[model samples]
Target: MKSIDGISFKSLSSDLPAGLVVFLVALPLCLGISLASGAPLVAGVIAGIVGGIVVSLLSGSSLSVSGPAAGLTVIVLNGITKLGSFEAFQLAVVIAGLLQLTLGFLKAGIIGHYFPSSVIKGMLAAIGLTLILKQIPHFLGVDKDFFGEMEFLQFDGRNTFTEMTYAMQHVEKGALIVGIISLLIIILWDNPKLKKYAFFKFVPSALIAVLVALGLNYFFRISTPVLTIGTEHLVQLPAMDSWEKMVNQLSQPDWSAFKNVDVYILALTIAIIASLETLLSVEAVDRMDPLKRVTPTNRELKAQGIGNFISGLLGGLPMTAVIVRSSANINSGAKTKLSAFTHGILLTISVLFLSPFLNLIPLSALAAVLLVVGYKLTKPALYVNQFKLGWEQFIPFIVTIVAILFTDLLIGISIGLAVGVFFILKANYKTPYFFHKEQHHEGEVIRLQLSENVSFLNKASILLTLHHLPDNSEIIVDGSKSTFIDYDVLDAIQNFKINAHERNIRLHLKNIPEVISTNAH
Candidate 1:
């Protein structure tokens, strides 16, 4: 039951069903992201296949999934226009993959460790809220917007807040019925009593909801033609009827554009941004892992590099480790990489032979699925827990969620990180050295114990403590635990030594280095 790579086949039962759920979630997202990025519709599916198959094979993460992401859509949109053609942009993508591989070798993925836990949780919560807000249009039967976008601002000039009201006013009758029923099915399937049945165990609630939605719409078509939810709001995939036709759609890169300096610049920009997004997604996914396994990040960069490289060669968009699909996989009971691999296989089969059946499923049904996923990620309990953790953790977490709501993911995380660092510095400033008074036979002795590393930031606190010391008291300055002391702090202690003579204060230095202080005449 165990593979040579140590993955257990015993979990296939759970992984296979989880894979079906992910395929359902990823199918529309792949198409929607392509539509948003201005790439060929097939291109997104190609990237998803590569991310699920090739990246899953090479990555150390057991559950994380990768694919064409909305985060990189703007970059691709501008990259294509700047380069003058999609072929030239494809060449840039290949170079970006090489750059990411270099980053893996250089161990640049260690940057993921620096982000605070509060910021990571905030990022997850923001994505959840964005998912709920963004799906409202689709749930109401409006399919004007693209998918996989977490940003508040929409490409169609509507913001996330306003889109809900617009969708409510323009709701489609048939699509609304399917969506409401699908939501109910998913909610009911999640009930503990229903889960006790073997049928619910083998058939995921998401897949069941999609199937029921398809059936409902079909019945409406046959029984009452007036209320039929037609093809307009259904899943749309570019036609690929023949093998020759599919082969023609796979684009080739323009190697002739290699000499241009802008090509290299674009490659570098994509490499840096994609790598950062991948790292952040991997970290968040790791936090959600039920077994609490740590993924090797550098290895993940290499896997993503390979996925992007393959995608570029076949005329696909850039990719990063995506959080939504990964979270869906986890919530569906996935235990290993087999689930992602299975989804890749399913995508290949479905696209090749079942496009007609797929095109029948309504967007409203898929939106309901995402609605539940979003609720779990941004649950009310998360806010209550963060609030209980107090201001230092709560402030950064709240700031990250609010900032991401208005700006974008990367910018919001940066703002939260700045706040987290500020708190670290403030804590260091206040408690750089521990000051205590001890009763002694030879009058009261005051001991100042410097922390392990006393930097320039700690100098102000040390100086204030030295200045406020009672006149003519015995003081012991301890540096035994310090590995390094800043010259500024050492000088303050040395200068204070000068004033000790006037006050007749007995100064005892323990492992404190002597620093010459210039006498101010």
Candidate 2:
């Protein structure tokens, strides 16, 4: 009762409904992420299967969902291009999975806790913005480059801004209609009146939106031949009639790529970033769970490693515990890992029987799905909240967003990390001690109240105050509340005390001990 108390988690109807919701949310994401990364569309579905089936079975998490991440879109795009081939990138993914396994064994999952919240948020916001900007062209049915292409200079000879102009000029009418209709359906389904219905509860809006998009395209083909969407503006799943045909369609990893030097570097990058994203996603899911469950971070790493290894071997993109689908799972009231497993089964079914229908779904509809995802990530509220937190949080958050937009993810994050650290040191410098002044029986009294732990950073502030003490003033340097005082700080106090007679200041110590300064010796 406590788990469900004040919580809206659904009852024991099996995880089927919850799993279906997750599947609905995941399907479009798989295709969208694949499009963004420029990887084969089937590869995203493969990663989804491995994430749902393999990860759920191996992981200790009850609510987390794993799949190809939008956060890794930029990395995949660059890795595929730099490694010379998709097969080579797949090799890098395999190595990255192995690295994750090693990290799990070494208990390096703790590294996830060290990333600054501001920087991580900035990264997510950056990815979300990138998704919207890239998807705009697709939403207008102008598919020139893939979805995750955020680089300023594009391969099509148009920069990021120029691409937008080009997209507006060459918009496809039929795809735009499908996209607008799908988006309207998704938005309208979220109305409180519609959500009260049991049917709406059982089926997710995203699924309904996609289905409507598919039907509209079919209608166009039959009744409005002039507005019919072409193959280039829709999903391309390389239709397969049988298991044998599908087997031939599966791309194999090139084992020869093991010799490439860039493979190892790319692997390291993916391993670290994927591990952080997984840890963070699971942590978030746990907070959302009314039962107050905690996922084992190290175990999650190993499970994800195994999943990625298999996905890469099968020519899938790198995967992680994705927040969007996982949040949908918990909200759908899934009580067990069966929800995740069931979703994987559904994905498998789609791959086997529904590839042609999936191919019929317009790209604009998928773009609409991702547009919502992007909006969630960069909601205007996030900006307002961060700014309210003041300069320390705002500056790094903005720096990370702009840097990632102009540069790439890795470099932008590194730069933001540096800024976050600098602000941390700056805050610490001002918090070393509390200074107070009051009139005493003897005369004007100045007190330096040491913090819980006074370190070397406090020495300069203390010495500067000591130097400015007025003549005939009574000064107190207290450390009664301090557990530890650095030797440098104590030495500064002693040196200040030694010169007190020249300024006619009376120096007193409450709990501080004398430490001879090296200057005196």
Q: Which candidate's TM-score is highest?
A: 1
Write model 2 residue lDDT over 1-521, tens digit each, in one string: 22332122344353677787687668767876798788988889899999998999898888889999977888898999999899989999999999999988998877666667788788778867876787788889886675435566676777766787898999889889988998888678767898788787666666788788888888999999888888877766656667787677677888898888999999999999999889877765676677888888898999999999999998899999987688667766688787888899888888888878777777788777767767777889999999999999999999989887877666787788899988877777778888999987867898989999988876776777678778888989899999999999898888878888888889999999887679884
Question: Which candidate should be chosen as best, given lDDT against the real structure?
Answer: 1
Which segments of candidate 2 are over 4 A away from where they belong?
Answer: 1-41, 60-64, 70-91, 148-153, 240-263, 279-296, 323-340, 455-474, 486-521
The parts of candidate 1 lying over 4 Å away from their true place are 4-6, 440-444, 453-464, 467-473, 484-508, 513-521
Which pairs clash inside model 2? 36-148
Error of 2 at 332 (Å): 7.1
Each model's lDDT comes to 0.88, 0.81
Across 1-521, the per-residue lDDT of candidate 1 in tens digits comes to 76634246998878999999999999999998888888889989999999988999999999999888878888888888889998999999999999999999999999999998999999999888888888878888974878666667888898888888898888888888999999999899988898889788778999989999999999999998876876768999777767677789899999999998989999999999999999999999999999998889999999999888889999988999998899899988899988988899888777788888999999999999999889889999999999999898899999999998888888888998899888777777898888889999978899999999999988888888887899889999999999999998888888888778798888888999987776622
Cα-based lDDT at residue 99, candidate 1: 92
Superposed Cα deviation of residue 359, candidate 1 (Å) = 0.8
